[model samples]
Target: MRSEAASPILAFHEELASDIRTGLAGPGQKMIPSRYLYDDLGSALFDAISFLPEYGLTRADERILRTHARDIVGRLPGPITVAELGSGSGRKTRWILEAIARRGSTTYYPIDISRAALTRCALELGQLPSVRVEPIERDYLRGLSEVAARRGKSDRLLLLFLGSTIGNFEPAQARDFIREVGERLKPGDGFLLGTDLLKPVPTLLAAYDDPLGVTAAFNLNLLMHLNRDLDADFDPGSFAHEARWSAAERRIEMHLVVRRAHTVTIRGLDMRIRFEERETIWTESSYKVEREDTARLAKHGGFDCLSQWVDREWPFAESLLLRR
Candidate 1:
């Protein structure tokens, strides 16, 4: 029984180690999967980032949900099941759930790779009347698949991909991910997508690289996560957090720029990696989109844009799409 319980943890560590090895040893720019940046500490730091004055994405998302929660919920049929991808703490989700619960009982499946986030989500959302919170501690797509399987044949699902998290993917990858999601849903099901709009380069840079340094702390925490989880001797202080806006790519990139060359040993993986001065490990990329692009993305994902609400204050979009 103990072994059975420990298997998942063992598998997670193995997968993490494998990804780190592949990412660090790969040709061209070394990179780490952005998902790894959301362990407990990383998630908490990100929650702090959302509150930073310079970071307005989270606020923009909440604003849309708060303003149009009922309108968005009204668009969907009753007896609906709600599922959210990467639902950190599910604080913004209250608006939608409250709106839904006012009509009928709701079963919310909040999926995330971070257990800490899921725990908080379950606790925070479980208190709502007529709402049942079922937290899924898994990556987005797989968790959504499980939700689909558990759903009744005629059930209408409202799948939410909020916080502009889709921006983490490259354009093509984003399309592929949405298509995969569409494959798991039935016709008439709905999708609520949040996307950050193209703004001034300075604003974009400020959101990712805030002057308060919360964003930097969030970026640097990824190294600390690796050090603790992988038994690695990474000098977090040796690498500085840097954010760059790529005009051509229409994205903001975060990287850890190594200050000096050094070698680090990963005792867990039984491997040693050498770093060169000025070389960087690309950590994350956040893509910004135009309003029209939301419709295009929905169409490519086998969804039709039903409606879109834009937040004027921060220039963010919340698009509602229905499966074709």
Candidate 2:
């Protein structure tokens, strides 16, 4: 984990100790933490999902950012530093970073929990003439304090939160996070935030459960990681991947279901576990936010909303928020 990602991510990791213990002692105990979903291979697979036709979130979002990046930079007043959360693969980030550098005076600070992703992106980004890469190896939540501390008196900041990753946080947590981030900026600073919006259950389901079955393979990758890293015996083939849309939360939840009664061993912890058929492990939640809810959260975060741009069909929305 990036040391800078924050205490909350560590808190979650510690919390997992309790969950992992509970999960092993009894049948149908607790769900696995979502953070474990990105074990190198999971990271690469998710990056591939960005290109899949069914997952239109990434492409549509990039379109808006690419179209209006100059406008966003212009509206920011001048000479801003660009800081991003979850700056994965540095694909869309290149646009905003380059835009800031085009002005001849700007810096890019990218914070991600993955050191490998950060190191690779930083190496590539360092090649730019006017760009200086301040790569942060920390979870976004824990690293927010350092982000606030790094701000200078004369700086205007542009915060990039693309990829709809914001959708992963629960509403209350999302509200708290946005508010905290807003408190760290100046009046002219802005957030170019991307979010996946409400959609048909089928459309949403397909995005998570692609025809290629790559998503399933992605979820099971976690089990493989645990076996390799934690010295656990998880028969990846014995479990099935499940993805479903939760209408109440308006999100997609991924689960891993044990297909048959089984026993497994954790060599690191010297523990044994038994699973029954149909036993499931919750892995991730991807929430789709309504416009009003998003705007209200932004307002509470001390931002005056400037604009919200959705796709041609309104499947997603990218909002431009100026700090108040």
TM-score of each: 0.97, 0.88
Give the CA lDDT, 0 to 100, for residue 203 in model 1. 88
Candidate 2 local Cα displacement, residue 92, angstroms: 0.8
Model 1 stretches astray by more than 4 angstroms:
2-11
Relative to the true structure, candidate 1 reaches a TM of 0.97
Model 1 per-residue lDDT tens digits across residues 2-84? 98546656767878999999999767899998988999889888999999999999999999999999999999876888999
- Which regions of candidate 2 fall more than 4 Å away from where they truly are? 1-29, 183-188, 267-271
What shift in Å separates residue 168 of candidate 2 from its native position after superposition?
1.0
Q: Go through the candidates in order and give the C-alpha RMSD of each one to the true structure.
A: 1.4, 3.2
